[model samples]
Target: MTPPLLTLEGVELGVGGRRFCENLHWSVSPGECWGVLGPNGAGKSTLLHALAGLRPVEAGTIRLQGTPIETLSRRAVARSVGILFQDQEYPFPATVLETVRAGRYPHRPFWSGESAEDQRLALTALWETGLEGFDARRVESLSGGERRRMEAATLLVQSPRVWLLDEPTNHLDLGHQIALLELLLRKSRGQQGAMILVVHDINLAARFCDRFLFLFGSGESCQGTGEEMLQEALLTRLFRHPMRAAHFGEARCWMPL
Candidate 1:
């Protein structure tokens, strides 16, 4: 049998002595999109960090393609896994094109300059993220939505096999949110890659993700696919409030009741 793209075994996570998840076992394979859902303080971002090897797990292990993540060098891991954090800051002045081109660093030899193909790939990524004409603009001058899209473009240029995104839709307008999700879906589907994203919007999660992971706070969690995971009771309990699950056409949505 083929190994999963990513796996967590007997995972435990916490911050400042507050536990988020315990004894967690999860796996993600190619062509799958997963949404990590939880209320505030549920450790969603912490979990993403753990998956990306940016944070240490309190216990247990994370494996990428069957090899323990800790055993792999950082550069080796970067070649296959990419992460997008919730907030990003660029301290130096740079054009959007220069920022996106940085994704090619991992693929190049040490101290090598960007190649024509790298530039082409970066431009393609920018076009895909709806930032084609903004490449020459200063990154600091872009609005929140534009900055988010530029980040997306950088990740696209990286082209990792497993994508870990924390609140990818942050700062995006409704249209841009949908457009970015669609772009990610196309990329994942085309390359048979996997995506695990932390998301707060239930409707958007339902629309894009094939599976859902819900953190109920304090070392409790549940995961499932389809309408089974979208149950009213499950959602209500997960959010600690009344929630109504409804459908419009083919989409499933949740609302506070």
Candidate 2:
């Protein structure tokens, strides 16, 4: 069997002196898309940052391709892992194209300027993200949803083996949400990629993810195949609200009662 692309062993996480995740053991393999479902303030974003090596875990280890992530250099980590953060700050001036091109920064040699091929790849990402014409726009002028798509375009151009997305569809309208998820799903399948994204939409998560991780925010968590974890009981307990399992046009869906 192939080794996992990313693995968390006995990981513990917390915020504000409260431990929300305890002994979390999960592995993400190539070509897999895992959804993280949890209520607000459950350390979902915190966990994504930890996986990207941005912050230290309270306990245990996170390994990237069988190597302890802590031991890797920042550039090394950036080359192999990519994160689509929940919030982004653009403090300086740059066009959307320039911002997306920054994804190539990790792959190119020091001081090597962006090449034609890099420009092509960036344009392809922009097209894929529905920002083909918006590339010329200033990053500061785009709306929140447009900014989200811009960030996604950057992540696509980066093309890392692992994707850590926090509420990737945040601020997106219904159509854009579906389009972005499908695009990411295809990318995840075609690029030897593994994805772990935090999502609040149970139906959307059920539709797109093959694996599931539920964080209960009480120092407890669970993981399983979607089939195993999408039970009504699990969904109800996950949100502290009753949920109903229904079939909608050949899809198994869970909705709150």
Candidate 3:
């Protein structure tokens, strides 16, 4: 069998003195899309950071392609794994195209510059993310939604085997949200890559994700398909609110009751 794209074995994560989840074992394989769902302060972002090697794991191991992630160099990790945080900023003045082109750095030599193909790919990524004519726009001047899409475009340009995204739907309008998720789904299917995203919208998670990791914010967690895990009682307990599961055609949705 092919090794998983990413794996966590006996992992523990926390902040201050509070434990988020302990003894966590999970793996993401190619062609899979996993959603991380929980209430605020549930350590969803922290978990994504830990997987991306931005934060240290309290205990246990994280492996990429069957090798310990810590053993890999930063560039190697970047080439294999990509992350999109909830908040992104461009302090320096740069065009959207320039920002997206930066993703190609991992594939180029230290002394080399962006190639024509890289530029082409960057343009394609921008177009796919609904920013076709925004290539020349200043990154700092773009609106929040535009900037979010620009970040998504940059990640598309990177094209790593594993994608770790924190609230990818942030700042997106409903139409853009659907478009972006559809684009990501298409990318995962086409490239046979894996995606793990932190999402607060249970409905959206149900629509796009095949697997879910639920953090109960009490050092307890669970993982499984939405059909197996979307029980009203479990969700109500997890979020500390009454919830009703509804089905609209073939899509399952959760609404607060």
Question: What is the TM-score of each predicted model, taking all chains together?
Answer: 0.97, 0.97, 0.97
Best by lDDT: 2
Model 3 lDDT tens row, 140-164: 8999999999998889988888888
In model 3, the clashing pairs are none
Evaluate model 1: give its lDDT: 0.89
lDDT of each: 0.89, 0.91, 0.89
Error of 3 at 109 (Å): 1.5
* Candidate 2 lDDT trough over 10 residues, lowest sum: 247-256
Error of 2 at 140 (Å): 1.4
- TM-score of candidate 2 against the unseen true structure: 0.97
Give residue 90's error in model 3 in angstroms.
1.9
Cα RMSDs, all models: 1.2, 1.2, 1.2
Q: What tens-digit string does per-residue lDDT give for candidate 2 at 3-34?
A: 99999999999988988799999999998999
Q: Which stretches of candidate 1 lie over 4 Å from their true place?
A: none
